[model samples]
Target: MTDTTSVFENSPEAEFGDYVALLKPRVMSLVVFTALTGLLVAPVSVHPLVGFAAILFIALGGGASGALNMWWDADIDRIMRRTRNRPIPAGKVSEGEALGFGLALSGISVVMLGLAANWFAGAFLAFTIFFYVVVYTMWLKRSTPQNIVIGGAAGAFPPMIGWAVATGGISVESVLMFMLIFMWTPPHFWALALFMKSDYAEADVPMLTVTHGRKATRTHILVYTLLLAPFALALAATSIGGPVYLAASLVLNAMFIAGALRIRRRDEAAAEADGYRVEKRFFGFSLSYLFLHFVALLAEAGLAQFGWGGW
Candidate 1:
């Protein structure tokens, strides 16, 4: 359970923007994009209005997860430089307000998603919220070095939920989409951990970098990036894949592997001398790596309309 004691004095009032910030809109945007991609790439077609509502509810669920996370982590958020300004830690919103807001959004998002799409997708979204807030945030984050490895599942679920919204069930394609994010996550976050340096350590978050050492983390990034390649390329052989996706995956995977290798070979002295330029570049490229792969998937979906996409 989260320590409910106030970490900061409550602000007089939380503005509308403060409320939005509590939602972690930047993270929510990624959720919306990936979930939207899942919906678009699925074999089934949904009414635009229905699809729109489903995506909205899913985004709400993601936001709810963020709120609850902030509420729970308020104590540590106050300590972490990267997170010190979050609504809860900064005193813009009270913990009670964040909790109540999160609960409200969670309920609404789940119930409305069930109504707008299928009950399966709704239940999945509910489970996702639970996994993120309870399982990941409350359980794994502070306890284990593998937190991000497992917690990554919470972020990975959006695309699957989007696929479920359209198909009313799961499939190889959806699972592949899920795996793509799941595999991509460790390296992506480990890179951030690499650059963020002491933030996680000061917070006592037990991130892989802190627990296993930077060398191990770098090696893990390379191994995961290598493992990610097979899954990415395999997706190109699926019904959703096409020439565009295959071409994109090939180039992206090559570059991603190269980036990982660069990180793996560098020592702390070299990194410090260069101000961690290589790691920072790797982190920035990681964002494009995932985005371009998804965009390639979307491109394949679009091309299919013209009879040029898919196996």
Candidate 2:
């Protein structure tokens, strides 16, 4: 369905690093971390080796999705400044090679995850790959401005998959973790879209800024941030939450809300004058914010073994 025909180039064979680049390492890191957190926080216990294998395969599944995304979006990647240097877009990797690589990894990750962990986790990984490539990439991505809004589910699934790996099931706690990521995705991405200039435009991607303009994007960011705060706090009420998580969420949410209000009140004139520092800082803080929440959750789980997680 993607118009990738004209985007081909004749170049040297791709290097090993090129294959790795195809995996979208940055995105994979988030998947690995969140997935690890999910496995760690689950009430059930898993052997260290089994848990490691599960996370590794889940990371591979995430990487496979990224590789296929690069393959499909090669045309647009060539146009977007941020993505122009990616292996597929740069001619370092052929589209067919990337496609084959993605498919192989997809099969291996899912089948092995099923064997190494549980069928549900493995099946979830398969559905995740399908949703990302078939639903988000081929369908929602170019078709709607709400693409990331729905597509966020692809990333949110890692934590749920991790939980499934541990417990072989889903629960309110795991769903809360999924919701935490789901609610955070929009504002997190919209911030990047805000200061990213015209990369989306040149690629013909209907990013919020490309569709609704910066004003609406800013407002949406604030609204999502406001909503995300309470959802995150709600996790503190679950079995996993503790005094530490509660304290961290309270302070973090206050700071996050303040940051969102600052961005909401910002105007184009002030943004240009300041190089969009506020938005950029908000973006950076968002990354830290997410990492710390998981870290707090992990801390609670760790301490809970000593009976300190709950109030």
Q: How well is each residue in 1-311 modelled by candidate 1, as lDDT tens digits?
A: 13433433433478899999989999999999999999999999999999999999999999999999999999999999999999988877999999999999999999999999999999999999999999999999999999998999999999999999999999988899899999999999999999898999999999999999999999999999999999998999999998899999999999999999999999989998998899999989989999999999999999899988887
lDDT of 1: 0.94
| Reference-based TM-score, model 1 | 0.96
Among residues 3 or more apart in sequence or in different chains, the pairs in candidate 2 whose N, CA or C atoms overlap within 3 Å are none
Please report how far candidate 1 places residue 7 from its true position, in Å: 20
Error of 1 at 67 (Å): 0.2
lDDT value, residue 286 of candidate 1: 89
Cα lDDT listed for each candidate = 0.94, 0.93
The segments of candidate 1 whose C-alpha lies over 4 angstroms from its true place after superposition are 1-11
* lDDT at position 177, candidate 1: 89
TM-score of each: 0.96, 0.96
* lDDT for each residue of candidate 2 in 1-311, tens digit (9 for 90 to 100): 13454333434577899999988999999999999999999989999999999999999999999999999999999999999999987878989999999999999999999999999999999999999999999999998999989999999999999999999999998999999999989989999988996889888888988899899999999999999988899999999898899999999888888988999999999999999999999999999899999999999999998987766
Residue 82 error, candidate 1, Å:
0.7
What does the lDDT read for residue 198 in candidate 2?
Answer: 81
